[model samples]
Target chain A: MLFMRFRHLLFAIFALASGAAMAQNNPLTGLLRSLTNTVAPDQGKAAATNQPTSVMGVRGLDEVALKDATPAPAAVVELEKYAASAESATAAAKQTGLQERTVSYQKP
Target chain B: MTNFRLPVRFGVRFGVLSLIAILTSVVCAPVSAQTFNLNAIGSVVSGLVEGARVSNISEAEEIQIGKEISARVLGAAPLVKNEAAQRYLNRVGTWVALHTERRQLPWRFGLIESPTINAFAAPGGIILVTRGLYASLENEAEMACVAAHEIAHVNMKHHLDLIQKGALTQAGAKLLEMRSGGNEIKQFAIGQGAEIFTRSLDRGAELDADSKALVYVAAAGYDPGACPAVMKRLAAMKADASSLAMLYKTHPAPADRAVRMEEDLGKLAGAPAGSGLRPELATKIK
Candidate 1:
């Protein structure tokens, strides 16, 4: 249902009217594979209900789902400030070349 | 006699303990720099969990193949000679992945030494954008757009799927373990994966990545407009088929890609998107 808003994003999100719809299952991350829709999901489905949760603040979104809380546009200023400071914050990663800078992405 | 004996014993014990502490520092001094590396510790912990085999290709195997492919790519063209530019790329690339679902991948971003306008994503998050393309970016948001696009491809495992399709009979991760120290099968599979990059991904994959990249950039607080902005730039570039054969062959026409995003781009017109593309970093891209 979340994929509805992204209809303009991929034609694959909407399948052919008469043909058997192909589910483009991306098992790599083992997440969001179910979001691939065969038909145009109802625009009014869970949109309003899910809105508040989806764009809840920046890093405070450690518990949010990827589909629901990708990033609220309103959070842009905070995101920018975060990015601006991210370089200086990650300077330790720079000193070591590419040895290992990333901690495992913990699934919230 | 008892007091003297007890005093002597206490002195001897203290001396031995101090000697042990000195020896410990001497032995550990070389690796003192790594004692506080939380990322390394996380990697080791993740590496252990990564050993649990995935269905066809384990995460470890996928990352290993990505590294091999990276080496081949570097061998052919090498990374750009500019350290500042490379660091900027890593900074942006790392930022985008941090907001993605597959954030734990050993993600890396490099501006390979190529003048052709193109970007490549190998499995397990090894993303390379050509210097020609890097020079064309308008700001950090656009850079995030490109990195997010490639990161989306990795999340979808597009290249890994292609490798599997090409070598399913011998490319299973179980086969990798059965023949330990035998990377021939792995090499063959990786070779197939590398070759897949030489060709274009299916239209569905490319379009899907475009959509997700928008989400990624926005999720990272960069401008979603950058997605359409970058595409419009590519659409403007008059790439000759012979000279820019790889870019020409691999990607769907930029016009078509831009067309798909028109509605979303229109919606984002008034949205407050944040981006801080430093002038210093911008000039170093060359």
Candidate 2:
């Protein structure tokens, strides 16, 4: 019975080792491909649009992909509302004896 | 065989008892520390974890953070209050933004009512140009180049990276810890994050943004030479001028930047040498 138990333990260890080896071989390629697909679905479209492709080692900004891009109307409206509300709040705070300090850019 | 079984049982029991002791101390330590007002350890652990989590901020979170920072900036120095000028700036800025990777961002542009010749870009596509800087520009292209530079900073997530780096520090950690306490604490944490933006990004990031700005402007069908021209003008400014001091302090030496741009100018050869100032925009700003 002891010999049988020892054999079972060795088998379990071997199985775990092989599983780890498989995982190492397959690294996160699947996850990375999915992320790439989701983030940039316009790779083909960009190539066809005649955009100034990145030349001087700069990688991120693709002028072609942005050819048809426009600002979101909702975000613009929200920004305007925020500006108006912030203006009113500042005025009210000043009237209530709050000091208006310039935002400091000095290193801390 | 019986003797071997007895030892095995004892070993397992001893190991379980030791683990329980360790677990008890680990669970109770924080409560005991709190009772004694020793929250430094708690804050440190919480801050590091929070900082790591924020390093991978989602697109929506980035916009929210940018909004908070923009509000602080507006509170400090309000918009120029000229509707026509504001509208014109929005048009130009939106046009330039449309030529970059993140064209879909809200991309609001405002001219701040400040005499300091400086411009700022908050995350989520908010760009602010100072009245002094706008007044100094000779043409629409110059203004567009400046706006493009700020946009590059946003697109590259410079401010977000700075805030995340700040989070790893003691002050940042404490602020992050306070963020969980209540709404007031949350506001304070955001204010701290805003402060990080005001301090400026590293020199490398500033240069990278400058390079990207050239690419963006060139791609938008503007004369790429305008970027180096602006840098040369800035380089020639007197260091003591109050308007230039803040800008000078935060950026690399203008002369060095100009030299770098000169080297990279060859790469933008095919970009069109568009008109400096369009007739419609000229009369409005004037």
lDDT of 1 by residue, A45-84 (tens): 2221221221222121111221222222222112222232
Using DockQ as the measure, the top candidate is: 2
Per-model DockQ against the true two-chain complex: 0.01, 0.02
lDDT digits (tens) for residues B1-286 of candidate 1:
9878866866775566556545434333322321121222222233332432234567898887877666555554456767667767877788778778898886777776666677878787778777877887877778888998999999998877765543322222333345553344455556543345664579888988887777676666556777887888877777553324466566788888888865554444223433322122344565
Instruction: List the global CA lDDT of all models.
Output: 0.55, 0.57
The clash number for model 1 is: 2
Please list the residue runs of candidate 2 whose C-alpha ends up more than 4 Å from where it truly belongs after superposition.
A1-108, B1-55, B171-189, B272-286
TM-score of chain B of each: 0.70, 0.73
Q: For candidate 2, what is the interface RMSD?
A: 21.3
In model 1, what is the error at residue B263, expressed in angstroms?
A: 2.5
